[model samples]
Every structure is written in structure tokens, then in C-alpha cells.
Target: MAKIEFAWELGAHTGHVTTMLPVAAALKARGHEVRFLLREPHAAADLEGAAEIPREGAPIWSGPTINANPLNLGEILLNFGYHEAGPVKALIDAWREQLRASQAVIANVAPAAHLAARTLGIPSFEVSQGFHVPPPAMPAAPLRDWEPAPRARLEAADRRVLNSINQALAAFRGNPLTTIGDLFAGRSMLLTYPELDVYPERGPSDYYGITKSAEGKLVPDWPVGDGPRVFVYLYHYYKGLASLADALARQRCSTLALCRGVDSDIKGRHHGGSVYFAEEPMSVSRVLPQADIVICHASHQMTAQALLAGKPLLLLPTQLEQFLITRRVVRYGAGLGIAPEVNNPDYTSALTALAEGSEYASKAREFSDRYARHERGAALATMIARIEAALG
Candidate 1:
């Protein structure tokens, strides 16, 4: 059996790890030796069995706002140390050593890994959400709705990062990348998000759809309730969540919230109320099947789950990535987006409308049915076939 390596050097959340798990597991099940190169090993404890390549350093991007200049994408990678000759050389050496015996590498938003793989003459592919991959050609207006950065500003930024990357890549005799989008370019790309959420300029193939999180298996028993069930899943923390939780508690509906950073002291105040907080990880798959409507941070995983289950969403997105997904949900008429503020009347109004109306529910169900028509695991199968062919 051919050995395969999966590399992830970017992204700070469990989404990067979870996004790759299913394909890795499926490869193992097929009798191939699958390994991982991870930045956060502790978070990926379940992947302990796989051989590892250590990763270091922090992500460069921060905050809820995004600068959608095509060149800003390259700058983010360069700032993260990819343009440093010492670091790039060290990474190349590590990848060459680990992947020397492997047949192929599949990277998830890990540009360094892709570069290293390319340098070693090993075939590689990328897997990720659509927004992560910039389009081949920079659009006049890169970001939808938002004004584009000035051409001169974008050109200056792109030139600086591109020159640095080329200089660093030169040390290993790697081909020069012409644009930030080239970093993500490959013979094949497997997108984990739907077309509706993809950047307007991209033409990615059929999305594999959101893979079910393994945590979905270990969710605790669902709370016993007959009232309209609301499942609130956030990114561990959000601004003004206490008030939002309070609003949910007072809504006269059964609310179950799974938020990681919320302490029991805060939860205790709402203990006897209709709202329940789970300090531990809960099975979204188990709970999503029963939710009447999902309140989330517009996470693709949860949003896809809610849509797939025919449940509308009340999205409170705090960051650009989540915000983009939220906009798509609204565009599809399957959900409403709310500002990340506490006690906003719009929040309650939207929730009341979603809870009391069937139009959103019907649209969500229709979208779900359409999405479900795509073969869930076919993309992985195609990827595996390509890997096997490349090795041969």
C-alpha cells in the first residue's frame, strides 16, 4: 500500500484538523499508511497513531475584519514565515525527510507544505473551504459587495511578497509562483464547502459537502423536551453572549447551548430556566437532527448541518469567513444574519420569524435536498484515485 501524508500548517481552530480526519481515516481503512503534519498535536489527539512532522509558529491574520486584496493573501503567508529563507529551508528539509517514502501529500491550507512537496518532486493536492482559495485571476472587485483595494496598493503588496517567496523558494530550486492564487493552484482541488459559499470568481468542482465531525458521535443524551428545540453552537466564545443566552432563556422555547468558554457560574444563573449549557463537547450530528432552528456563528460545518437537516439558521458571525458564509445563507433565503451584539431586537425578531414561519424552513429543506444529491464521499474517492495514479 502506498503511504500518504496530510499536512496542515495554517488555521488556528479544530476545523482544519476535523476537515481532514474523514479522508485520512478512509485512506487508513483502505489499507494505506496515512500520516499527519500538524501545528497543534494536542487538539488532534485522536490522530496520535499517525506518524508526525512537527510544526511551529503562529498564524498571521487576526480580527473580525478582512482586507480582501488578492495580494493580501500572499502577504499573510509571507508574514507567517514562508518567505524566510531559514524557516523555508528547514521546512523543506523536514517535508523531504518525512515525505521521502510517501507517495503523495494532501495539504489543507498549508502553503509551506505544498512548496516543500513541490520541491521534492512529490505530487500534491489541496483540500479546504472555498474562500481559502483565491481565484486564478484577481477580480476587479476581489471581495463581493466590499470595495476592492486600490490596484497600486495590491500590486505593491503582491510584488513584495512574491519577490520574497521566490527568493526563499530559489534556495531549493522550486518553481516561482506568479501570484498568491498560484500557491493554492494544483492539478486537483477538493473543496469542502458548497458552491453557494465560494468566492464569486472561483470555479471549483462539486463540493464534497461538510464532513460529519467525529464529536458528533460522543454527544451526550439530548435533553428531554417537546417544545420548539433551539440548538445554539458558537465558536467557544462571542461578544455579548450572556445577554443572547438570556434572550434565548426568556423566549419560552427549549434552548440547549454548547459553548466551551462559558463557566458553570454563568450557566448556573440560567440553570432552572429553559436554556441549558453544555460545558463539554456535544454531538452536533445527534442534536442537529432534532433542532427546529440552529443559532450559530455562521460556521460552515454547523450551517451545512442545519441546512442538511432542513433547519433554518440565525447567524451571528463575528469574522469575515463566517460573515461570508452568513451572507450566502441569507442569499439562499435559508437563514437570517444578525450583528454580534447583545439584546438586539433584530435578533429576537429574526428568531421569532424563523421559529414562527415556514418559508425559511421550506427553502432550507430544498437546499438541503439539492446538496444531498451530490455523492458525499466521491470527492475523496477521486482524490485517492489520483494519488494512486501519481504514485504509479
Candidate 2:
């Protein structure tokens, strides 16, 4: 059995860790040794045979969100140690130590690890839900294609980030990372639906299509209520969560909220005959079908799941990444978007519009029907087959 290494260095959500678990398990079951070098290793503590190693990622950037007026996916790397060579060089050495001894690499949103794997001549696999990167051939396409940046400005930003990456490689006695595409050498299965792609200009490839939503933290326990069924996925980080929960309680709806990373007391204050909470990382797979509408920060995975279930959405985005996804959902007529900057959003009106309106539900069902042929089981089997073949 060969050794397989999985890394999730950047990105905020625990979905990164959870997405890697199935692949790790499949490999382990086949007798290949699996190790996950994760930003949040505890996320995979339950995966029996796989070892979860932490602190091997590139230095975290606690800087302002927009390190530059990012034109494309590559320019955004400036916020993640690509602004300076020292940080990248140091991380390259550290990750090289961890990776050089491994047989293969599977990465998601970890550019430094990507560089390390490339430098070591290790064949790597990339997994993403679109927007994590630009296409392999065209590395400088606009991420926010709705507000396209000038070609000159885009070129300048690409030059700056590439210089930083290459200088770091040179300082570490490694070959220069020539193009932005080098960061994603695996040519990702590019897992996402065509409509959901935030960078539409980059266009399509052998799109792996969307996978099934991972199971929720707890099994569905629907509350008893006479009102509409509304599913909510809210993390603890959003400041307006408690007030929003209160609003959902006030509304005539049977709500099942996934209070991800939330405290029990928060649920205690909100949970009642009509409102219930799951205080863990819950997937929308099981609950989406039972809901008339869904509420979330427009995370791509959750948003996609909602549409797949023909459930309309009330999108509350908290960042540019989410805002883009929210915009796509809104454009598709399947959902509505609220700006992330809003402090006291009108949750009542948003819910009313989604619940009372027929158009949103119609569009959501249209999207679901249009993509009915895309099977998650088949997509997953394809991914497994590719990984196994690469290892062979």
C-alpha cells in the first residue's frame, strides 16, 4: 500500500476537511496509508485509520480581506503569503519536509502545498467546487465577471503575484512557478454545475458536476408547526444570528436551523415547538427536500444543495466569495441576495418574499430538473477511479 497525503491549508469552513474524509477512507479501506495535513485537524479525528496532522500549512494571513483589488483567482493569492517571498519560501521548506516522504498529494485551496508537491515531482489531485480556481489553460480570467477589470490592471496584478511565487521558489532552490496555472497542477475535476460558476468567462471543462451534499452533523428531527418548513444553515461567526433566529421563531414556520459551531444556550433561547437547532456541522442533504425555503450565508455547497432540492433560497452573504455565489443564485431567479455588510437585515421580509412568492420556487425546480441527469454517486465513483488509477 502506498502513502496518500491530503492537505487543506486555506479557506474558512470545515467543509474542506469533511470533503477530504470520504477519499481518505476509500484509500485507507484499500490498505493505502492516509494522512491529512489540515488547517483544522480535529475535523477528521473520527476517520479511524487516517492520521490528522496540523500546523503544516502556510502562515495564516490575518490581513484585511482584499489584499489587492483582485481581478482573478491568482491575484487573490496575494492575501495568502504570495505578497512576499519570505513567507512562501519558509512554508515551501516546511511543507516539503512533510510531503517529500509521502507518495501522493490531494489538495484543496492550499497553494503553498501545491507548490511543494510540484517541486517534489509528486503527482497531485485537486478537488474544488468551481470558483476555488480559474481554468487550467486561462489563468487570468476575471473572478467577478459581472464587474470586469481592465486587461492592463489584471496583467499587472498577475505579474506581481507570480513574481512573489517564483522568487520564493528560487530562494528555496526550487524551479520557478511559471504560470498561475502551476498552483493547480492537478487540473481539478472542476466539481460544480455550469450555472453556479462565479467565473463564467473561464468557461466549462470536463465538469465533474456537483456531488451530493455531505450528511448533516445530526439526523433530521423536524419540529411540529402549522407554518411553512424552512431550513437554515447559519454559522456562529455571523453577528446577527441570534436576532435572525428570533425572527424565524416569530415567523409562522417550522424551522430546522443548523447552528454550526454555535453554543447550546443559543439554541436553548430559540428552540421551541416551531423552532429547532442542530449544534454541529450539519449538511443540507437530508433536510432540503422537506423545506419550502432555505436560509444561509450563500455558501456554494449549501446554496447548490438547496437548488438541487427545488427549495427557494434567502441568501445572506458575509464575504466577497459568498456574495459572488449569492449573485449567481439571484441571477438565476432561484434566490435573493442580501449584502454581507448589512448589520440589521430584514429577515422577515426576505423570508416572506421567498415563502410567499411562486417565481423563486419555480426557477429552483427548473434548475433541479435541468440537471437531473447529474448523479452524485456516478461523479463520486469517477473521482475514486481517477485517484486509484493515478496511484496505480
Candidate 3:
């Protein structure tokens, strides 16, 4: 049996943790020894069966815990960039000691994980839920296709931030390349999003099209309301749904806003006739199955769960990259995409059309059926088999 070490940098949110946990559990069931290294204190609860590697001395950043809203800009940027080097290095040092006897390391997309695994001279597997990062062959692209001079300038600033991040990872790993992909030769990346869901399939050899199963934390207990109940999920640390919340309330709909932390500033904002206030984050599996429609900002967990539950979506994507991805979902008949800048005048009207429409629901249901037939367990099992073979 192979000794597998799974490492992650984020812990509070359950989406990614949940994704890798089941895989680790499956490996253990198959006679493989599994160890997990987490970088967050909040992630300890999620690491029930696995060994918990504390990050108290690690150079990891523990920024304010907030919903995945645009208001939490600092946390989002820190997450995207490995700027908090102290905590990361500390965590890596601890992991190095813990993994000294392990056969293989499964690193999440975090650049630090990659560097640590390399430093330990172990093969690393990159598991991702988002778009396959731009290969070293391609430079960072604009998040949106059509932006003016000012927006273009802003995007350039964002690119600089990412470039510095690349440089930091390279410096830490003693590599000069500006991209993470350049550092890992012969590394395999498993893309969990289904091929049919992504735009213009490039069909990369290493990209595996695996559909993840629906696993949610809370049970669905949507209150019986007078009108159509709209569920809006804001789980991102960089994007906000205040405008969408306002628009939903203005349209006279009963809205359930699922937020993560104690940010009461945006609560009680009226969209049109709809009342907007912060509600606790609910399990998409339990909530999406009962909602008439879902509104979100292109979170993979929320979007994937919504699609699986066969619920139509109204995506209000703020990031240019997210906008492009979510636009595909709308084009594919899975949902509607509302540009982040749309004002109250037009926002309510667009949302009304989506909520009243049935086409999106039909298409989402069809995709869910196809995905369910593919079976998440089989795909994960195959991945475990491959990992075992690689260890040998």
C-alpha cells in the first residue's frame, strides 16, 4: 500500500476540503495510508480522521473570515498570491518532517504545496476545481474580453500581482520561471470539472474530466413563502452581491441570502420589493433542490451543486475571468449571466426574465442527469488507482 499525503492551504470553507477528503478516505479504505496537512485552524473540524498539521507558526495569513464577496479584497488577493510567506514556509517545514516517510504528495493548487513537495523530493499531483491554469506557453489573459482603457489598465495591475506571486513561488523553490506549471516537469493535473461544462475544450492530455459528487453541509429547510423563493449564495472573498440582493428584493421576491461572516452592513438593502438580509450559508444540496432559482457569483461549489440539483441559476459574476466562465453556463442554457455593473434599473428586469423562464431549468436537469450517470465515485476510484500505480 502506498503512503499518500494530501496537503491544502485553505480550511474554513468545506467545498475544497470536502472534495479531497472523500478521495483520501477512499484511499485509506483501499489499504493505502493517508495523511492530511491543513493550513487553517478552521479546517481542523474537517480533518476529523486525518492527522492535523497546525499552522500557528506557519507564515499563513489568517485574514478576516468573510463570505466570498468582493468586499473582502485583501483576503482574496492574499489567497491568490502566496504573499504571506512566513506561515507558508513554517507549514512546509512541518509538512516536510511529517511526509519524510511518505511515498507521494497530493498538493492542492496552492503554489507553496508544489514547492514543498518538490523540496521533499516526492512526486506531486495537482488537483484543481477551476480552469486549468494557463500553461507556461500562454501569458495571463484579461478576465473579460471587452473592457475599456481603464478596465484594461486595472487588469494589468492584477496581472502584476499575479506575476509577483509567480516570482515568489519561483524564489522559494529556487526556480527562475514566472509560472508554476514551468517548475513541475511531468506533473499530472486532474481537472475535476466535466469537459462538457467548460468552454471550447482544448483537450489537454493531462487534463482529466472528472465530475464531482454533490456533498453539502446543511439540510434544506427553506421557509414556505408567498412568492417564488430566490436563493443567493455569496461564498467568495473577492466579489460582492449587494447589487444583486438589492435587485432581487426590488422584484418583490422572497430572497434567502447565505453569507459566511458577521458583515451586517449590507443587510436589509432592498432590491425592488424584495427584502435583502444576511442569512447563514446553507448546503446547496439541501437548498438548491428546493429553490425556484439560484443567484451566485460563479463559485464552483455553488454552481456545480446548483446544476446537480437541477435548479436554474442567475449568475452575477464580478471578476472578468468568472464572467467569461459563467457566460458559457448561460450560453449552454444552464442559467443567465448578469454583468456585475448592471444598475438597479436593468438588473430587476433581467432577473425577472430568468426567474420566469423554464428553459434554463430544463437544460440544467439534462446536464445533471448526464453527470449523475457518469458517477463521481468511479472517477475518484480510478484516480486513486492511478495514484497507487504512480507510487510503485
- Per-residue accuracy of model 2 over 324-384 as CA lDDT, tens digit each: 8888899999988789777688888888888888999999999899878888778877887
**Model 1, C-alpha of 202: deviation from truth (Å):** 1.5
| lDDT for residue 266 in candidate 2, whole number 0-100 | 73
Q: How big is the positional error of residue 91 in model 1, measured in Å on the Cα after superposition?
A: 4.3
Best candidate (score: TM-score): 2
Worst 10-residue stretch by lDDT in candidate 2? Answer: 46-55
Write candidate 1's Cα lDDT for 1-392 as tens digits: 87888777766666676677767777777888777677665554433332333333322222332233233454455555554456666666666776788778877777767777788787887777766677655421244355555677666656665676677789877889887677766543545555355475455455566654546334544455445788988755676577677767667568888886686666888886777888666767778887898998876767777888889989998766777888888988998888554444455677789988899999999987887765656766776676677877
**In order, what lDDT does every prediction score?**
0.68, 0.74, 0.57
Evaluate residue 345 in candidate 3 and report its C-alpha lDDT on the 0 to 100 scale.
Answer: 33
Q: Please provide, for model 3 over 1-392, each residue's C-alpha lDDT reduced to its tens digit, 9 standing for 90 to 100.
A: 87887766543445555556666777788888776665553442433443432222222445553324321222234444333445445545655676779888775544556666677667777666544343343233323345432444434443543455444445456544443345444565555455333324434555444445434355444443455788877653524456555566556667766666525556633423354444433455566667778887775656777777778788877664457658778877988876767554366766777777778789888877866765666677677777777776
Q: List the residue pairs that clash in candidate 2.
A: 216-283, 217-282
Question: What is the Cα root-mean-square deviation between model 3 and the actual structure?
Answer: 6.7
Clashing pairs in 1: 219-283
lDDT of 3: 0.57
